[model samples]
Target: MFTNKGKDVVEGSSSASATDHRQQKQASQPAPLSRYESQKRRDWNTFGQYLRNQRPPVALSQSNSNHVLDFLRYLDQFGKTKVHLQGCVFFGQPEPPGPCTCPLRQAWGSLDALIGRLRAAYEENGGLPETNPFASGAIRVYLREVRDSQAKARGIPYKKKKKKRKLMKANLDNNPNISLQQS
Candidate 1:
């Protein structure tokens, strides 16, 4: 009976210590920042600054889809096409190198990813998911229109690569019946 009681006491103390240690550890560490949080913050700041320079300054929360559209269009003005980037790399010259076959517009995939990141950042920064302007149907439709227009202009279809299936390896040693085949 005494031995059992001692064991219970030891177990109780160890568990208590463990709980205390966990609490302490949790208190000491800060929560991890969301992915691309810094980049999102920088983008927001740049947009905010742009707004401030306008005739009438606008806050990020109060801005509508039109403002977002304008911002995206503004980004397009500075975008370099893959061909342009290649020229810059090959010639070791800055952008505005000799023109090439590709259009000057940004790639649909890159713009889509940027929008996704912005949407996530908007939600993370206290914007409601349902009302997020970045994730609005209008924005999606605009992107689709842009993509279609660019594809039509360039005569190239935009295609995303499909994820490859992972091969499952069987434990041949444990399952003696399984035979390894060399292809």
Candidate 2:
């Protein structure tokens, strides 16, 4: 029962009308990101940059390492693309709350692409792409052509196979009864 508005709290409102009102109220309230969660994201961004600038990528848990690399990749990509690229380092975490939000990978890709475009523009305007750290090795390449190229030059990761164990010649010589198998 209502007194201030002088209207029945429930009986006065039709069931369908009440449902519509409830839906509208729910729709208007924006979901908020919590402070702790916001701080975590900020920390992640900071940590990402730290990992990226590292000349030698530090040994870390797979997920943490990947996260940092992803962030670094994004930063390098972002720096190249964003205009007024003057700073050697970006030092601050973003404000905890902002309208902008993106998945870590998506952010990385967007930033990388943006950097690529910026790098191209810089070169077009007579700026040297070679000087930019983010410039891909392929961009700096002067080679005309090659049949097969080494992956090492391109910074690709690979695993080397273990060498097969070899039997000692002395051991073979000592064992007269043992015949060597066909090679």
Candidate 3:
């Protein structure tokens, strides 16, 4: 009874376990998706759905930055963050003492992150990077505007921290003015 691992799918009462028996018969499979890949797939599906909802429906091949921008704006209606309009009294307040008539909207950070995922998904799904709506200059400028507006509304400046440069020892050795000192 123990020797028939693949040849028989007959009754089994062995301690090898039912799940184990199935695993032994199966071949090696591809690796599971990473979190980034999963998110990209979800974002891609969502963008496709949005395109389908457009008037007369837009195909992925024909969609452009304008559609992407419109989609982002459409998503603002379902946002959780409270972004006040210019006319609102709490426009520049970090936190208003009381809730007003201001509408809640998505944060600029969230929108930016969503765009990054969608951009990767677009290329992964056979889209040309140069022609990708998510990677367009219009989308970039729109994101920047959102960041600036959100920062101003929240009374905090949004700053992108620059990466620090590492000094290479090969360059130091080539230069005569700079010397390593042993204290």
Candidate 4:
């Protein structure tokens, strides 16, 4: 009888310890935020607000490529370009008049980064990665066209920077006529 009682106590203690371990594990783990979560949340909220203010109301998830492109164009209206940055000195007493009063255009890099964030946000909000509107080829092509057109309009080179070739000492030794000029 004593042996049986002792066995029962041992089982009860073991079960209690198991429960305690589970509780401890649950308590120790911290809830983590989703990837690019904050930016995604902000982009969604901004898009939501834009949709709300449209002539005919549109749902955020119902947005198409055109709507996304239009949203980017809208952002470009207020974006500050490099020229605007160059003219503005924040520390000056009484900001200079006519300090780039023109509304800034969005650069290619900024738009690309924004689109990436939006794509991540869409997936996080339960939109499937495969079917994500932001990840569509049409959207990417449209952005490329936009960037190219914008660069042309601004008279800026649309081509990416070419990597400079490094001249090796062996090459220089082979061609004695070649000489390095100090700038």
Best by lDDT: 3
lDDT of 2 at 59: 33
Give the TM-score ranking, best first: 3, 1, 4, 2
lDDT of 3 by residue, 1-183 (tens): 435756644455554587687787564666778998888888889889999999989998899999999999999999999888888888898988888887888888899999999998888888998899999999999999988988888788878887443455666768978876776
lDDT of 2 at 146: 12
Model 3 spans with C-alpha error above 4 angstroms: 1-21, 24-30, 162-183
Q: Rank the candidates by lDDT, best first.
A: 3, 4, 1, 2
- lDDT (C-alpha) at residue 121 in model 2: 44
Per-model TM-score on C-alpha atoms: 0.55, 0.19, 0.76, 0.54
Clash pairs detected, candidate 2:
81-115
Q: Candidate 1, which segments miss by more than 4 Å at Cα?
A: 1-35, 82-103, 158-183
Best by TM-score: 3
- Backbone clashes in model 4, listed as residue pairs: none
Q: Give the whole-model CA lDDT for all candidates, comma-separated.
A: 0.70, 0.42, 0.86, 0.71
Q: Which window of ten consecutive residues has the lowest lDDT sum in model 2?
A: 142-151
Model 2 lDDT per residue over 15-131, tens place: 679889999998998887686445445554455356556677643222232443354444544342222111213212222233222222223234444445444443544545455
Q: Which ten residues in a row have the lowest lDDT in candidate 4?
A: 86-95
**Alpha-carbon lDDT of model 2:** 0.42
Q: lDDT of model 2 at residue 46?
A: 55
Report the lDDT tens digits of candidate 4 across residue range 30-146. 876575676677888897788778889788778877778778878887776632333344212233344444346777778888899888877878887887777888889977976
Question: Would you give me the overall lDDT of model 4?
Answer: 0.71
